[model samples]
Target: MKSEKSKNGLYSHFRLKSSMSFLMALLVFVFSCSESDDGQMQGPEPVMPPETSMAPDMSMFDDEGGEENRVNTIQNWAYAAINVGVYSSILYSHLIVPVRAFKVTINQEAHFNEDAGLWVWEKSFEVPSRGTFSVRLTAEVDGTDVSWTGYVSKSGVFENFVWFDGTSKLNGESGKWNLYESPENPEAWLSNSWEIDREVGNGNTSFTVEKEGNHQGSSITYSIEKGADYDRTVLINDVSNSNLVEVQWNKESKFGRVKSEAKYGDEMYHCWDEQLQDSECP
Candidate 1:
């Protein structure tokens, strides 16, 4: 027979042990059902922009084609190409260098922010054409879109210029990009808003550039599509007058056509030879 004091002590010890076992089992169940990243998981990075070759690389319509080049001929293609070239200039001169800098993930490092649940890429890089720049890219999940932003600070120059921002599908089927004016032109910084929309799985993209804040007379839409007779097709919309300029060309043959009612007075397609001179359509 055990003493009363010994029995009481044994009872208390077994009771405490049973409570501990139940507490541990409850903790195991909670953690099993609700596993958290605890701020350690790396988020997804942004996708690289569509190819810039989406813009046609054609010489200016200065000589040869003349007035016929100006209108009523394949010159409509020249005219539309001219506008696209302008937007290309803005992108290459002010915005492209930074985008090219951090897009490569091979050597770039991405830091994950647990609090914000974002993946940030920052780097200082030099372009042979342009000087060095500090570029930062951030990406986070937003509904069905992966929201991303790009900020650039030139070396020994201005800091924190939000050169661009946009969102893409998590699977990268499509997206839109908004570009701002360079910090050098502060008066128009963020005043310039251009939109880029990518077609789903078709390898095509359309860019609409708004002039000043006006979309009536000066807006231009440039798009690229794959074609049958031609390897590539380009469509440019003169949004003000609701006119469409279409260019179809073979990449190797370098022959193409331009069709527009605003420029040619008819929707008939006009052809240009390999030399980009006026020719009869087939």
Candidate 2:
């Protein structure tokens, strides 16, 4: 009987140990499920570097000043061309190279900017030869106002060079132009040559003449008239020598038609359409 009782005790002890182990496993599984149901597992958040505190560089602004200077240079040259054209036209109209005496009136006030070193003037006047002429002048000032005056002879020589008080961007510019008959025939009176100089800068930004021509047919007359339809008409007639050229331009369309007839050539017509395309006379 004692032996049987000992066997029963051993079996009971094994059952209790197994039951305790199973309960422990069930509790562990339940804890894992609860953690899974609660969104994601919690941990420390990642860190980022501190923000910087520095100012931006300002060297880019310097280029703007340089660009403005370049624009001023271009404006100065453009104005110079206008002034030269006006003076040349006047000389041609009078058939006088010396330009003994003349008067110029500037209707618009001279545009002067002391800080930017810029000056601009625009005006229109009448010339005996050119009929009516308009002019514009822009100048750059280093210390004083820049100006120049020159005279061209009938034989295409530059004389009486005069420099104004100021410095000019075209100070050293010089150009010569000649119109000859043809490459082979040298004997021709229907040709002329002229030279001009802008007594400023490097003097290389102008036209040059390699040969001279001798064409003295007759005095050329130029007339510019404004039309009723806001159009402009330029008539160049040398009727004494059988040379005539007429140009008409629309103000809004900016289209132009040119008809030219010369003593030595056939009649030619050209047109610039509204789209700024060049075509046969329309």
Candidate 2 Cα outliers beyond 4 Å, as residue runs: 1-104, 108-230, 238-242, 263-268, 280-282
25: Cα error in model 1, Å? 20
Which segments of model 1 are wrong by more than 4 Å?
A: 1-49, 52-77, 94-111, 127-130, 184-201, 211-224, 239-243
Clash number by candidate, in order: 0, 12
**Model 2 TM-score on a 0 to 1 scale:** 0.24
**Per-residue C-alpha lDDT of model 2 across residues 164-230, encoded as one tens digit per residue:** 1112333222211122222233232121221223232111111111223222343222222334341
lDDT of 1 at 42: 43
**What global local distance difference test value does model 1 have?**
0.59
List model 1 lDDT by residue over 1-282, tens digit each.
569889999999999999999999999777644343572444455554444322223333334456555566556446545645554565555556644543543257677666677868788778667778877877786555787677788867888787667777765556666666567653332222222344532355555553365442333343334455665655666565676767677666677777778777987988877777668888
